[model samples]
Target: MSKKTEFQALDLISAYSEKKKNPSHLELNQIFPNPTQPRLIGREDTADLVPSMERLGLIEPILVRKDKGKYLIVAGERRYRAAIKLGWKEIPAIVTDANEDVCYEMSLAENEKRKNLNPWEVGKAIQYLRKEKRKTAEEVSELLGYSGRYVKQLSSIARLDQKSVMELMISGKPLSVKNLEELLKRKENRGGETISPRPGSGSGRISINLSKLNGRVRDNFLKELGLLKKKYGINE
Candidate 1:
């Protein structure tokens, strides 16, 4: 096996060993190390997770690092938060080797599996892997088990304005992935040109026909759609 594979196997073994050592122990002594790095965002739905943990307990262990007899949580912030909310004194966690690059990769993988991360968070993760870990975008995508084009698309989404993002979150529109791509393209064009759409262009229309868009032109089209919505009271 490669070094990476060996490390992963050992990590899993250590996790299993820790779990088997004390099946009923609750005073988990690990102090989460990377507390500042949040793997999950949008606390609006956190209440839902709490009850599940409270009922069945944490099914998965958090990843952590040890420092001075304290384990710092590296990933699984949501699980930790839920545990705290449910009044659990101790939670399960996996102690892994202190490889910053690998830790980051694992963190991203963990989050990617559990929830649909926002574009900004995904972009930040990708950026961290590239800038801090010196991994190429393609390499990062490969590590995350995502396609290179998918990674590039996520990076592009990260560059959208907060207003546009808010629109996406609040409008409750049936926005397909293709629609989001079109919206992003529109935002990019608006940045280049000072052209603003006439007021009341889209009238709050939610559904967009992505097939009509052709590269950069789609950006202008979305801006016009937003303007139309602002002008008219279309609740789509």
Candidate 2:
């Protein structure tokens, strides 16, 4: 087997071992939502999933970790909720001994199985991997199947103020990376300054023409930019 396959098998074995020790069943009261879950599941989305679950039953078990006397969901929240909606007494679950980092990673990976995660959700997951797990952009790109360029862009979006991020989440509008980059640029410029370079227009938006700088100055500026990024923990 490939190294990745081997690692995944080991993880399966570990989870199975933990389940044997815990022997959990997903009783309604016993299962809790993950406190740190970043993705939101609207009732509309769950409405569709409920029918499939009713017809086929749960094809996969939800993953959970022990919390005090209860089990907190590590993955498969939609399945858990659908089962509850159908008034099912219990559902299958695998209780694992995964730590906080592993739990977060597992939840992220599980959500990605359908590749339906929102851009904000993707950004948050990448942020967790970068900041919490201390992974590089390349590492996150490989783990999450995002392009290297897009991963850096997502990382930048994650660094925005939490209030702005919260506002975006509340808007519930689909996010485009291009739009997010534009938002970031305006935020950095302060007061939503216009960034377009139009003829016979003035908006007090600062514009830099790199060609105006001498080679040495440009090189030095690039070096300084790198240093600033490193200092501020910006990824690119």
Best-performing candidate as measured by TM-score:
2
Candidate 2 lands at a TM-score of 0.62
lDDT, candidate 2, 84-111, per-residue tens: 8999999888877878777776777666
| TM-scores, one per candidate | 0.61, 0.62
lDDT of 1 by residue, 109-153 (tens): 555555556655676676766767788886766566666666776
* TM-score, structure 1 vs. true: 0.61
Error of 1 at 88 (Å): 2.5
Task: Assess each prediction's global lDDT (C-alpha) against the native.
Answer: 0.59, 0.67
Candidate 2 — worst ten consecutive residues by lDDT sum? 1-10
